[model samples]
Target: MSRRFSPSNLFLGSLFVLAAFSFDQLTKTIIADIVMQPPRVIVITGFLNIILSYNEGVSFGLFSEILRGRPEILVFTSSVIVAGLLVWMSIAGGRLEAAGLGLMAGGASGNIFDRMERGKVTDFIDFHLAEWHWPAFNLADVAIVVGALILVSGSFLSPQQDVIGK
Candidate 1:
């Protein structure tokens, strides 16, 4: 089948992207302005803690030294990635695929916005279990991870999406 955009799927994809971007940005803004003023950790649950922290690097704090004082590079790279994902989304075969890609693009754009406007990604949600603490992350990261999982799962589940074989 020729890959094409159904109007309904496109609309749904756009809605998911906009919603993700808005929620991610709003949470980060609130955390930066109101939650981090005094720099104290707030315990929301036994497994989760909210603390304001800045990530100058990509996931897992990678490339902090290389990207130091050079946020434009990060912003540019992220924009390129988001753009690529958007193209993939546009040519995607189904609403599910487009929705997943939209989520990823939105999340990347959110982090890119933070890097452009503030020079760093604001990470606040901290998760831990006993002595093991996962790296702090934000709503954007959540969207990206979940979106990736969806995309990967779709690839595996929908074999007929391939034209040559199933």
Candidate 2:
């Protein structure tokens, strides 16, 4: 088998993708359907709260107005991105890169599923301080961000040969 398709790399990549996707969907379902039936905010800590939100657009609600009635566009675009991420993961130079790409792919998959089923993405988990409140997001979003950080930090820590083989 080619190095890009090594058994270990494929296993690790698939594992992260499945795990991230499952966890993200489970959390979203529980939080949005079971816990927040009435759609009210629940305080979790000094800076955290659970509040349900349906985002009709991309990250941070950008272009929401323009995409208000066009969910197919978001779904199509996101699906393409997820496919690209999976392709990258398959050829990832190291475990960290594979895991990061898998996570991003999984998160994007979850959002795509949501958009297809509900015509919007379900978001919750709000962070705030004083009067300033960050936009609400979900577990999938967390996975994507953490995965990105892992990839970045790994790049800085690992030797050049580890990333691009000698």
Candidate 3:
């Protein structure tokens, strides 16, 4: 096997993937099925609330109208993206890159699993300032964003030769 796909690399990457996926799924289950049984808005702080929402589309509810009731398409698209992430992770040059890719893959997988089983993604984390509120999102979304940020920041911090394996 290639150096990038060494046992240690793959194990570390897989560990992140499993951790992200498990945590995302566990949080979703607890919030959706247990805490929000009655499905009411729960205010935790001045700026945050738990409001159960089902997102039928991609980020910010975009394409929800088109994607609603058509989860198969979303599932297919998301699966493709996850597969690509897995391939990238397998060949990642550094541990940081692999970890980031794994997180993205795991987050995507969580949402895809939701689409397949629930026909939509459950979102509950709500942040607001004054009257304006950001779109509600779940742990998976957080993981994806954090992973992307890590990858971007890593690129800037690491030497080009190290990242590119030159």
Best by lDDT: 3
Q: What's the true lDDT of residue 123 in model 1?
A: 94
Give the poorly placed runs of model 3, Cα more than 4 Å off. 1-4, 159-166
Error of 1 at 19 (Å): 0.8
| Cα lDDT listed for each candidate | 0.84, 0.84, 0.86
lDDT of 3 by residue, 27-74 (tens): 999999999999999999999999899999999999999988999998
Instruction: Give lDDT: candidate 1, residue 159.
Output: 39
lDDT minimum window of 10 residues, candidate 1: 157-166
Ranking by lDDT: 3, 1, 2
User: Taking the tens digit of each residue's C-alpha lDDT, what string does model 1 give over 86-160?
Assistant: 777777777677788888888988999999888999999999998798989999999999889888887775635
TM-score of each: 0.90, 0.91, 0.91
Error of 3 at 75 (Å): 0.6
Higher-scoring candidate on TM-score, 2 or 3? 3
- Which residue pairs in model 1 clash with each other? none
Candidate 1 wrong stretches, greater than 4 Å = 159-166
Task: For candidate 2, write residues 1-166 as lDDT tens digits.
Answer: 1236556655787788898889999999999889998889899999999999999989999999999989999999998988888877877778777788888888888888899999999999899998799988988898889889878876775534344223
